[model samples]
Target: MFQIFTSFFIIYGSKGGCPMTITKKLVPVIIACCLLFSLFLPSVQAQAAAKFSDVDPQRYGWAMDAISFMTDRGILNGYPDNTFKPGNSLTKAEFTAMLYRLFDKYRPNMQEEDADLRLAGYADVPETHWAHKEITAIYDYYFGGIAFAFKEGVEEPFFQPEKKLTRLELAQIMYMAIPFADDAPGASCQVIMGMTDIPYELFSSYEEADEYRFDGRYSEDTGISVDYYVSEGAPVLYPLVLVKESDGSCSSSFDDYSSIIESAVASMHTSGIMTADDSGYFRPHAPVSRAEAVTILNRTYNYLKANRNLQQYSSLETSSAAAGTPVTNPQPEPPAGKPSSTVNPAGNVKTFTRDLAVEGELETMIDTEGYRSITVSIEAKEKVDVIVQLGGKKSFIRHEELPQTIALNGIKQVSLETQKRVFDLLNRDADYTAVLTVELK
Candidate 1:
């Protein structure tokens, strides 16, 4: 069409078949047409590249780019009828297949002779299963001290491939796949434990606390054999602290599962590899849709492509050692005659302020003598997550609840959670700072 139009214009203009005024007008029209054609060419090509029958542009527009990217690379495929069922829930087997394709470079090559030997372990994922190869491949690659999709509490050794994948599970897979620095999981747990809010006087009586006690040995989910207490009176039971054994190691039945989920979700959320919904909530237990799965996988791929130095967790033994190690040492006291930063020296109550950038942190030692309560006011120019650490305890503040005050009943040395390497990788551009005010009463 362009060739014919150009030929007609050339012949008509050269022979004066068209008047100069008309020819001058036609020249601008030709240029305009060329510019418009150039602009639409890519869109046309893109549309032809990955067209799905069921995905409506208005509803699934945000996911179309990701769907297209994955489809083009053959990481995701539409149904035989040419429909991409974006709303359908993603299953474990399906996710493994997608991950196997997405991270092909990271996995080992499986030989036909060795396939049966490697795949023989899973009782449910038989040779007849559709995603047996993918399951085998992913299971062979260990992450966070276990194989892919490894779960506790199963009576028989089986891989439930047809089970719908949850948001938390996907986040965990991505977290393991990226394999943050060696200390990341531990540091993430610290942030989680620190952010947990438990009232100091919740369990007023020993009997009340005893009623919520759980021995770690009895809980098959978390194999740590030790006694610990939880606040069962609350809507959700919150693990308080692990009981210290004669070996000085703390033990608790509150498994690493919750911590890992929290850590994975936090890492994913902060890094923009995956994000929460409009309410700033990452529904960890919610079932993942096919569209959401691909979109997240696409983001993970892009992140990995850009970041080449990411260290993968090598040995399960070493990785396990990185998480749940107890800190048994007593918190050191603040130096005498040294006043707290920005605090009034003469009063029983002390107030101080510190400023920090996104992913930035501040640490200060406060003499908590005669103080029964601690309050922190966070003021940020934009919404941001902040971690406040007091001695061994930590608290996390979400952005939505920002420009607000966080009050804790007990006093501990004031500090902020500082996992610099993890935060640095998560957010590089630290242009703004959140102001935190600490007050002891």
Candidate 2:
């Protein structure tokens, strides 16, 4: 069993029920402390502006820390548009390539052996892929190839390079693949603890709050965690905090690792994922992103759902009906039908005329009032299937997966549930355009 970094966080228990908790105020003491911590870091605007000392684990996920550590050290970038798809699963080859970049510090000065597919290897992965070089190298070191006595003479060294990397597996692989990962500052690997080889200087204290530094450079002007906020009444907020592996939850503070989490969360707000509420409390520990970071972004674009009930909100405000909205209505699943030869077959497609609006369940919705409500439909040709997504303006509410059949005539459907509040926009450049991932068997 591996004792990796704990994932349990407790960001909210009290003012409960904000899908996302956006921070609005600043603790002066924390602000002052944040300033001093900045002094020790290398002076660079990007680095100074962004550092790991900040992370609201509740709002952001462990990836935020990974991202921050990579970014401050000058690595890993979001799209040219400046968005990080944290939840997308990466392939073994892709990750092996990333490992190469991340561990540039080691400058291993090794070259990749040409992908020798004649040896034992996964049938799906081939040398043609971009990560072929890195993937092959990793197999030689980390995951030894499958050994079968019957084919020993004929079997090639198998590299399951095309496998999808799991989050836990990725963590474990990254644990040792950090190139020449050294202890932070005064850390010495002479000792060992739950995290890995102990860095005596870094781990002298077990509490994150005590061990992490906070300088006054930090400001209240950072991103929020929860993606939405109520227009009136109480401000919907989610707290971001971390805990050891044993703890069950939180909506408020944590015993350790708050500073790093606070910094990471703040940075993630800039990167996206955790948006803000109208009131503002970056509920950093209110668990938001899950599985992979790419999916976190994909959810927003793909109407990718948390797949959990809306009850997860600290404030169970998912009671309002979205039937009044032009875009929402309970849509029964379309009956199975024969292929409409005129149209390409779609994994899923929904077609409706412009004036007709389909129904959907929105965990939450945001309306600017300025723009007229536009009804959009998802269509597909007979050749492929797609996943259509629609969203609300204020909340991170989604009208997920309205598959459409491919054709001149296509059917796209979405399920909406709640009409909620207004949320501050994080990325002005966020791609709001409907996305379609096509898979044809």
lDDT for every model? 0.50, 0.29
On the 0 to 100 scale, the lDDT of residue 127 in model 2 is: 69
Give the range of the ten consecutive residues with the poorest summed lDDT in model 2: 1-10
- The regions of model 1 sitting more than 4 angstroms off are 1-35, 42-50, 108-120, 140-156, 180-255, 309-441
Q: How accurate is candidate 2 locally (lDDT)?
A: 0.29
Error of 2 at 134 (Å): 1.7
Residue-by-residue lDDT tens digits, candidate 1, 415-439: 4432211212223353345455656
Q: Quote model 1's TM-score.
A: 0.48
After best superposition, candidate 1 residue 328: deviation in angstroms?
Answer: 36
Clashes of each: 5, 114
> Which tens-of-lDDT digit does each residue in 1-441 have in candidate 2?
011101111133224553333333323434554566566655332332244333334544434534544443333455554445554456655555654554332222233232221223333457686765555444432222111011123334334455454333343343223211112111111111112211112222225532232322111232212111112233221122222212221111221112222322332232233333444444322333222432232222111112222222112122432111111212223222322111133323323211111111111111112232223233322111121222211111122323322221122322222211111113333222222322222
> What's every prediction's RMSD, in angstroms?
17.4, 27.3
TM of each candidate vs. truth: 0.48, 0.26
